[model samples]
Target: MIIGTAGHVDHGKTALVKALTGVDTDRLAEEKRRGITIDLGYAYAGDLGFIDVPGHERFVHTMLAGASGIDTALLVVALPEGIRPQTREHLQILSLLGIEHGVVALTKADLATDRVADVTVQMNELLSATPLAGAPMIPVAAPTGQGIEALRAALLASVPAARGSGGHPRLAVDRAFTLSGAGLIVTGTLVSGRIAVEDRLVLSPSGLELRVRGLHAQNQPADHAVAGQRVALNITGPRLSRDMVTRGDWVLHPAIHAPTDKIDARITLLPDFRLGPDSVRGPDSFRRMAPGAHALRQDAEVHLHLGAAHVMARVSLLDTDRLEPGGDALVRLTLRQRIGALARDRIVLRDTGATRTIGGGMLLDPFPPRRGRRTPPRLAQLAALEAADPIAALTGLLSVPPGWTDAAAFLRARNVGADEQLDFGSFVRAGGLFLLANTFDRVRDSIVAVLGAHHRAAQELPGLQAERLRMALPDRPPVAGFRGILDRLLDQGVIAQDGPWLRLPAHRISLSPQDERIWAAVMPLIAGERFRPPRVRDLAQALKLPEAAMRMTLKRLQRMGKVTEVAPDHFFLRETMAEMAAIAAATADADGLLTAAALRDRLDNGRKVAIQILEFFDRIGVTRRSGDVRRMKPDWPRLFGGGG
Candidate 1:
């Protein structure tokens, strides 16, 4: 279990830590001069991990960063200083951080006299409304170790048992840097989940995927790390820099968790500041945080502490703009920096103006649904976001791209688990833009709708070519993304094609009225005959129509399935093949030798059309190749109603 220490500067917090671990926590020169814990320091005893934090007012942000991931807190108030400016502020921060399991450490007990009762009473009054209110308050002296053993016992007893859910590893990165001896290293409390050496990882909010090069806990190598334990990690991959990453970053499983920028929270302000302890309002009073406010918005410009990351954000009040002190209200905060914040995570709010403790709230949405500047609906969405099934909630609000999900990363925002829809090898062939299965269905339906409408507009056209319809998609990334999905649809029998042309299998182009007229006249003129049909020029003259109009009619006739071309200038009545069948039957000899000229004699209408039909028959395998002539297949007599 992880525990943190909080108190005023020179309150003997470091001395207490040293007494607890026998290791000096002050690592900075400035801190040694002043003899104060200027930054976060670390130590541990057995399974209980310790985070030593600075109590100086100037180091509150540092304190927050240190205290963020611990399961318990140790509130230290010196016996003589009982409650200084930072003492109350630290208490407020603890309250905002939701540190339910903690002990109140009353240090410098050696200086206490009969006045101890008064100081204790005052401490109790100050802690009344905070998480430490009912905690055991033990007075101890770090120099003489007056109450060290009892303090240790109280710390172990006060903090609850570790979380045993043993799910995936969720590491909130508190410190990350390249180690001189071990390469890349990161440290934080392993909130839940486990990490083994060489396991793959994805750092979230920044979304960098890497592998765990090594692992450690309390400066020693560890085989595997688990939830509720403080851990240090050595990782290697791209984007390994202090600037590339920072505190509050998440060491995600890649299979779980999504990064979000918006969150709806129920903020509560602590009652320790001068902002009228009684007038300290909840998150709902954040809207008045706008610039140039009449009353300085202490809760206005909030330091939103979600997970292990602390970000600045503007708060929108849920109840009222200016809230009464100690009042509670749910509010929405928009962050200025991105981090690994998810729905339902606890968030501590720090008042930027006074740099004091405000309160903590639960994240309603990992990525909140933005609805203009209105606060009510966003609050409602946050409520949904905090539901038991947060992933389902995300799906309800997700606007995913269409097609088979190619990579699992794209569907993270929808909370699609690897075990859910996509696993090892289910190819999502949305062209190259594969998305999740459901996303692909959405794309296919939308494409079909648009294409079907286009089909109806020009019955003479097969369908909107795939290339053409792809242009209509929103933003139109590329057709490659849609390819995998199209193939799936084709296999499902939802779509069909004729050679290179795609169309609904049940669809056949129909002729327009004037085109139908042209078709009827041309049908008989060509009849059981095959030859290059007249040029559009001669045909228009024969039909007394414009050449362009006649040309359009011929194209329309082609779409209507009434004609086919055997040569560049050729056209054939759909019935021409039948006449070729009859002629080939009469002219064939016993040896299957039949002259092209003999077949031409039977049609008599023309040699060109007859030979064309025979050649068409040969191309289709209805007539077999025999020397220079063509012969009907043996089954021709019964199949085509003719005898040899």
Candidate 2:
């Protein structure tokens, strides 16, 4: 398990890590001389390890990059300066990031009296609503080696035994450097995945491919490493250097995973930053940051520092206006800019002015949906993430995008996966094919509904048009998706199709009382003399039907061969098609010859339709040769009449 250190500057964060592991975190010359950590430092202890981050304000951004993947936190407070600015800020960050296991280390206990008990009370109050509420508070003096063993024991106990790390390797590089002999070495806690020697890998954001040259844990070489293990990897590849690889860059399997810039996260603000509307804002905040802003508000604007990139973002809060102390937030951090991120990565946020660490949280989505201040259901959608099970966690995040019909492939494209076992509440039957848990019955119901609508109007009519299907489900998946859904419905005998239309297997059009009115007053005017037929308005008035509804019914009737519509206001019976076909065939050629122009003028059709007809005839050898005034081929009868 990874243990993270947080407190004010010179609070012994480094000393504590070193004392526990006998490894110094002050790798930089400036840090030792300045007597303050300006960069991220690391070390390991028996089984517990840590990331010792800078506590000064300016380096809060650096601290954030180092704050990720820590399962346990050591909130260090110097006894003399108990509960300083960064102290409060770091605790708030830990809370937001969901560091459930932690212990308070009060340094220089000898310098303050037992009255320093007040400090622990203050610290507990700070953690009140956070995951670490009521955790152990230990006072220690590194100089005297006081309470050191107790601190170590607490950490070891806090870190749970490692679970399955047999999947892909996810190495988040918080520290990258070149050893004297080793070309490039990136060090970080192996958060959740594993890696092996000589395994091919890639650095994110740039995706520069490389090979793992070597591996180590706590500065010593290791054959392999697993999740929750603090390990250093010796690597080499093109353009692989400290500059090319910064903190937050992941060393993982090549095609298995990539980074994200826009993400969904759970965040909370620190108690101390004092960020009011007047506070200086960062470039990433879409809107201003006000004072007393304690919660991650829905649609609230903020900045996200992911990996090496910074982005302007909007917040999607879980359920409340404010996250009281330890309360959690289900927020979507929509970035105006792009950054490299992976699912479930942790991040830190700071005030643009003082650059103080305000809060940080774990990213649940690399590309989260944009919900501009929606209803409570949206917030509830995010609240279910705290549960274990990756599949369940993903299913909970399922929501339709604005103007979308379903959400499966969209989720898949973003690398979201569900357990084969979890089911979505909506199904194809409910017009929710994108949901994971939908059953076949739901799919059948959806098909039946569409077919039923068509059958009720006219059993002999074709199903709904493809475009109509698309429009009706403007918010569902896509129409091209219907084929697969229909296939399932057909297999279940829920629906059938005639031509382009759909229907229930046993269903047919059975016109209602309105149909009797239409049939009695119509048909006569349309069965013959289809060309230049009576006006549709006259037909509607004759049938005593509303003009618009009449037109719809007539179109449906005509499609079903109950009536034939020849013009915009005129329709003809299907039976008249034979005579019309003969009229068309007679005009095709004269003296056993045909011309493209003759076909156009005789048919009085547009260029496109005329060309289409002529092309069909030509392809069938109905007109060929004879210097473009085409002679009728032997197949003329077959092409124009028999075959048609």
Candidate 3:
């Protein structure tokens, strides 16, 4: 377990850490010379790691980086000074980051022995309002070792058990530098998942892929590390350099490398925010009346600190134009630069001047839509994202308007593997997307209704073409998912495909009387040798008819969905075509690729005829060809009632 120290400057946070562990946290020459931590420092005592952060107001940003992934917080309050401004701010930041357990160390006890009781009361009052309420407060002086053993025991009791490997690894880089012979190395908390030596990772925002050459977990050399540990990785890549990677960048799995520029979140303003001149009047008037009361107004530019990244962003209010001090509301943050963010990632909001932290919140949707952001449906989706359980959140999202959810994107944003075995209950899967079962049924009925309207308007035509029919739907379903719905309808016999057209099962076209006689005479001749039927010229000569008339009749038959034209003037009966498709589906290899020679052997037909049939399947979207090999397409099952 990793423990992060939090409190005011010169409060003995570093000294206490050194008393517990032999290593001094302040490593920088400047830090040692100045006797104050300007950046984050690290120390370890066996399995417990300590992230020592600067306590000064100016270095709060640096403190947040170290505080992001700690299992427990060590609150270091000076006994003589009691609680100070930074002590409060750091505690609030810890609570915002969701640190629920901690131990309080009232340092400088030797000097303030008489004042320890009074300072303890002050600490108790402050702790009562935060997540660390019942935490034990021990007084210790690093110089004299007063209460040192008691403080150590309290800290050990507060450490939570080791965390599980939950998802893909994401390390927010807080420090990056080059070693003389070791190449480039980065150190940060392993936010999630596990990382092993030699694992390939991608540096986000710039998308440079790198390979991990070595690693140290919890200040010890290890071949692998899990989440909730401070890790140092030695990584190398062709385009990589010490300068390319910085404090704000992330090194993560390639699958989790998406960087987003917009975020929808619920932000709460710090009670200390000063009311601006344009602050709106309301129940928060009492707060405005305070000397420094302020409001966070819409379109206000601010500094957004997430992970280790700090970027400028413009806040767009969703539920209100102005947010009073100590008030919370839903809002959208449009960032000036992209950052590697994901759902539930904690964010710190600072004023544009970077003077003080105004507010902070958790990200709901990192990849939010630009339009209709204030709509009720979008708000409902945001509400659903508040659920702590991913499955429950997905259940809520699947029930929202249009009832279509991009399942892959939702899971990916939460660091949940899309291929993981999740029980979605009754939600229907359409390729990588999902829809409510009821919504899918409505889509099915809508498809039938559109076809019925088309059949009424154009009685002479067979039906509507598949693409045109899809375009007519109100939902405008995606191509891959729409094909799945169409296949289900066809399998259930609720819809029928006539050539390239889709229609209700009852729809049919009648041949003219004169054409009817010719079709009757031609049916049996082709049926006798359906696998290798004669061409239009041979059929015309057999019937002693004009070649043009035979071709015209065949083209008319094509429209009626009686036959498929495998090649120019060469046709096969619908039943025969379905049979050939089944043969191809059965003959393909495990990889779904089949060659003309394979199909020819299966059907005992000539190689030329098999090639012609395979080419036809390609044009109709059944198979995709690469050189001599053809692989079945996702919609290969759509044609002829789906043989593949």
Q: How does model 3 score by TM-score?
A: 0.81
Cα deviation of 132, candidate 1, in Å: 3.3
Top lDDT model: 3
Worst 10 residues of 3 by lDDT: 282-291
Give the clash count for model 2. Answer: 26
TM-score of each: 0.64, 0.66, 0.81
Q: How high is the lDDT of residue 224 in model 1?
A: 85
Model 2's alpha-carbon lDDT is: 0.64
TM-score of 1: 0.64
Across residues 428-489, which tens digit of lDDT does each residue of candidate 3 receive?
87756788889888898899899999888866567876778889998778776787788778
lDDT score at residue 399, model 1, on the 0-100 scale = 31
